[model samples]
Target: MKRRDAYLKLTRHNGRAGTHGTYNPKHNDRSFNLANSEHIDPERAKGNIYWDCFYGFRSALAPQDPDDLAATFSEVERQFYESRYSNFVESQNERNAKIRHTERNRSIPDLLSSRKTCPEETIYQLGTLDEHASGEVLLAVVTEFIEEFKARFGDHVHVLDWALHLDESTPHIHERHVFDCENKHGEVAPQQEKALEALGFELPDPGKPLSRRNNRKITFDTACRKMLFEIAKRHGLELEEEAEYGNREYLEKQDFILAKQKEQLAAQQNKLDELTLKVNDMETLIDEVSAAAYDKAVEVVTDVVRTETRKEDMRMIEDTKKWVLSPERKAPQSTREYTAKHLDSVLGQVPQDHADHRCPLAGEAPEAGSPAERQGADQGKSTGFCSATAEPLAGRADPTKAICAAYRRKIRKLFSIIVRGDVY
Candidate 1:
């Protein structure tokens, strides 16, 4: 549920300084009259003026009884001036360098830096009574309300000037004060904590660390509302209290947002850590995947080579069978003649116009006049893969034996690499 709005408003202004720079009673007086619409005072113009004092029952927030208001203002104003606090205030200001100590004191040095004597003053409306009512109704209610407040409040707080202002947008009492800022034993109290307890009101818990700081302001604002509420009850007024203290709600919401932001930051950090761990293992993961792929590649290449080798071996065997099964073996000729016949068979399979597409093999190339080159073959010319022997099987009728041996040697060399797991 939404909280009801506040009807009473207590405000403060330090009387130490005026709009120009320093404290000036004339400046305060002008402001007071302007606020209360007393510059063209209606009652004073009629010559049937009700009172001759700064304040009276007639000068209340809503003066219903002129006699009573005049009397109250007279009594309070008389007591205020009789306090004889001006000498103390003037001397104190001089000592603090706020003003010159004497008319002819040019040679004297200041004891302290200039400062206004009173630092703060306070004021507020009694309740919402001014909103719904005017004149005597407001005056009567406010008078009773102030009486209750004074009876319950501290004595160290001295009222200097007071007036009920009906000329404002809403009626409120303007009160000036000099907080007797020292404790009972004559030592200064921080933020007037001990001084405010002059009536034996409950002392604030010292355990609250901020009692001297922010809580000091909050505590007083709370106390003002409490006092008004209690008094408004006796007057049958319907003032309500707002739930929020000035700026308190905004500050609390900011704290909550800040806490959530911190949590999100922590969560993001955790996610980053997990990602970092994964990145650290990336090299190992890569090696594992690479090893599996290499094994599969070796298996595929070996199977393909073996299948081609089998077909080549069968053809070579068929060619050699013609030579070994022939009756010409019983009348074998010289090795050179047999080699020449063997070369013819192999050359027949090669295109006659493609002689320049030379077959190259391993080892040094034969010299121009050597037997290998003479038969249209060379060595040490790269074929992109491992070199094979291409030694003049041309013009040799027994080419089958040499071709078969070459095939076996190449197959064996490839198989050994794959079997030993060294292909990669």
Candidate 2:
């Protein structure tokens, strides 16, 4: 049995980053500038090509372009913010577009950066570089695997792009895709744990809370590995389900050698050099601590002021609430209710002869037998607001009703202002 291994990793780098450029030599600046580098053989690099993302068969292979993937990312992100976070955009201006904070706050790149898991890369290879399966067989398996992958995760995971590289030590496919789920605002945003959860993936340790060791992504990756292994088995290549340690184990021969050399050199460093490094690190730490302490002190003082201000405001609100809801004080009423319920009580508060209490034309008390005069006589009081003296209008006006309406309007306005905390 020719036992191979399955390789998959969820990297922090998003599609637009330099990693995509490295995967496709056409987009790599280093490939153009440093063609002599051992990592990529110029002649063999010609065989590497991007996946044909079209409906019909292509005459030739499509060349990999990072800009195409980046454009897709940009469009998706633009729609997400424009559709769901319109409030955040509306609150912004030319001066504070980047500074404004709200409930749905995020920067332009946050759609990519804020995600816990980013684009994942899956490599389909038989074995180590020195011993591996034929390129034709690997290609066929990977092509079928990509189809299965799309069917499995197409909903939550979007395949941005993939490339088949023939320039590397072994033939493999470098496929990249982002995970996303609908956020609270109904926007499909790039998120890892939530996306996986939406896809029905559970934590590795169901009993424990989600953490670095007990994440749902860990379970997700395991399922992907199993799928890859099963697909490889179907294609007549037996794959090893054994786990690999060290992230750098999959690097190219030249890069691996350089990494080992760096490790050896670090191990062989002189004590004097190590001491000097520690002393510099200590100085840097001290500077950081001093700056952090000053910032924390300022934050504490500002919080104290804010807390006291809030306490005073709350106290004022409570006082207003008590006065407004008191049983002894009459709640605000309409003009008709005020006249019927508190007409006598309110009239007694003001003396009949007070200039302000009297209407503009106090001399025009209605004729004794007039309806207005009879109403006042029945009340048996001269409260000045009696329609007899209070009518600002000519003969036919009822001034008591007019005064009650004005008072009702003023009372409503005052209550509204108090509830809004605008009294201060």
Best by lDDT: 2
TM-score of each: 0.36, 0.44
Instruction: Give the winner by TM-score.
Output: 2
Among residues 3 or more apart in sequence or in different chains, the pairs in candidate 2 whose N, CA or C atoms overlap within 3 Å are none
Candidate 2 C-alpha error for residue 392, in Å:
99
| lDDT of each residue in 76-190, candidate 2, tens digit only | 3344445543454344332264655354555544544433433544555566676677666766777786688779888887665555667778766566666777777565666
What TM-score should be assigned to candidate 1?
0.36
Which whole-number lDDT from 0 to 100 does residue 136 have in model 2?
Answer: 69
